[model samples]
Target: MSTTQSDRLRELLEPLVAAKDLDLEEIEVSRAGRRRMLRIVVDSEEGVELDACAEVSRAISEKLDESDAMGDEEYVLEVSSPGADRPLTEHRHYVRAVGRLVKLTLTDDAELIARILVVDEAGLDLEVPGVKGRKPTARRVEFADIAKARIEVEFNRKDQNEEDVTDEKEEEA
Candidate 1:
């Protein structure tokens, strides 16, 4: 996608997303055979629902129709959440991944799979799952040491209820 086009779209549509309480994760304009395809990925701290996507899509589609951002081309609009496997990049992304398992590749060519315990500005407090029945251990992985980080998908997680990745808005009384 063109850099200017992406910037323009973000500039015009970000407020529309913010109005509905979502973070605009990414915007891509691509060719779909004879037409244009515009993909908008959005997310919120609580995660996005189908209705949220539909609402954002409608708002954005209407704005695009009124504006010339797409340059008079017929385009398809798709809005959705970042999938389960999306890479963790920004500080907000790591913060959102707290209490969730992630696969991290370090700058030293080592890989660690751990659940995020806490995320600060500099690094993450991770609970490295133990092997051979050993108890889990805490490990600190600095953001600088991370080469790549992606959320690990777990199906049939036995301890699913134990890790609540939601924001802690209420403290224990």
Candidate 2:
């Protein structure tokens, strides 16, 4: 996949996505069997809903159809939100994942599991989980030092589960 084509696609699609009040997270073109596959990932602070994805898909598909961007090749257009486990490469990804636990791999190959407390252009403020009954410590990690970062799924989150149960009970009452 050529970076030029991807950059062109980003240039073309970014405004369309921004007009709809969403961020164009990523655009990738890959060979799928005989045809090509264009995957567009869109996201928003409020989160991307199914309708939002469909709307972006429709708009992007129409734009692609009108333009000769795909070079007369039949391609599949798939627009979607970034998955929960998607790498936090962009600043907005970190902002969106605030309050969520994340596993970050540093450039030095050090791994840290921390809850995102803040995100700025330069770096992130994370609450590193304490061990042995100690309190969590606040740590700052610059984006340049982060090699990889992904949200960690907390399966047995008692606080969140209790809140959900309470909301359900209230709704039932």
Candidate 3:
């Protein structure tokens, strides 16, 4: 609820999370009817697994149980990875979104939908989709110029596996 409480929780849990090679993305404390909900979002470049969440949950639960940081309030601890729609706020977020389609909103309020091609310390290289059989064009956006960015869900995403299979079929032919 308060910044102090959130900071305390971060102080208590960051090391435990980092020990498992995960980044503590967020700490949210909210009221759910009678009890408090402590939602902790953790992630790694390789992705978070169910087992990893369970492990982190167990560790954090034990630490909270031992410490009086929760102040006797009943709280539900939820450990999870940032979902597909999570905003791309960090450089690593952009790095992870490479090869995925994203909706980018500039600080000036301009918007563009492009596929990520590269990620560097300063900016990103994107392939802007073309219309009417036109070739896609490359564009670079400095990170400082972005207001918000999120991955666009693609149900039929063409990953490298499918392309490899197609190439194998062609070779067989």
Candidate 4:
């Protein structure tokens, strides 16, 4: 899409998403065969749920139908939250990832995998896991030194199962 078109789309979408209490993370316009594909990525600190995405999609569709923003083109609109492994490119993204595992690459080309203990304007306090029965260590990384970062998906985190057990016990009380 041209710059003007992209800007116009953002202008049209920002308010709608904001009204729904979601941050518009990304907007991608692409060609899917002959039709255009409009992908909207929205997120929130509490996370975006499936129903929220559906609601946002419906609202976006209604607004577009009432406006000439899409220019009557045949386009598929998809609304979704960022994936589990999506790159952390913004401060807010890092803030949301606190207490989650992540893989970080430093500007000096060093790689580390750690759990985010805290996030501040300066950087992150990461809890680096230990190797071979050693204790986990804490490390501080400044934002300027982070070359790239991505959340590490943990399907079976030990703490997760423990939390579930605790929740079950609480419910039984």
- Candidate 1 lowest-lDDT run of ten: 164-173
Decreasing TM-score order of the candidates = 3, 4, 1, 2
- Per residue, candidate 1 scores C-alpha lDDT tens digits across 1-173 of 55689999999999999999999999999999999999999999999999989988999989998999999778889999999999998899999998889999999999999999999989999999999999999999899999999999988675644455332333432
> What local distance difference test score does each model get?
0.92, 0.91, 0.94, 0.94
Where does model 3 exceed 4 Å of error? 1-3
lDDT of 3 by residue, 38-147 (tens): 99999999999999999999999999999998998788899999998888989999998999999999999999999999999999999998989999999999999999
Worst 10 residues of 2 by lDDT: 153-162
- Candidate 4 deviant stretches above 4 angstroms: 1-4, 159-173
Clashing pairs in 4: none
Sequence-dependent TM-score of model 4: 0.89
Please tell me which predicted candidate would have the highest TM-score against the true structure: 3
TM-score for each model: 0.88, 0.85, 0.94, 0.89
The alpha-carbon lDDT assigned to residue 41 of candidate 3 equals 97
Per-residue error (Å), model 3, residue 172: 3.9
Q: Per-residue lDDT tens digits of candidate 2, residues 15-42?
A: 9999999999889899999999999999
Please give the lDDT score at residue 171 for candidate 4.
100
Model 3 global lDDT (CA atoms, 0 to 1): 0.94
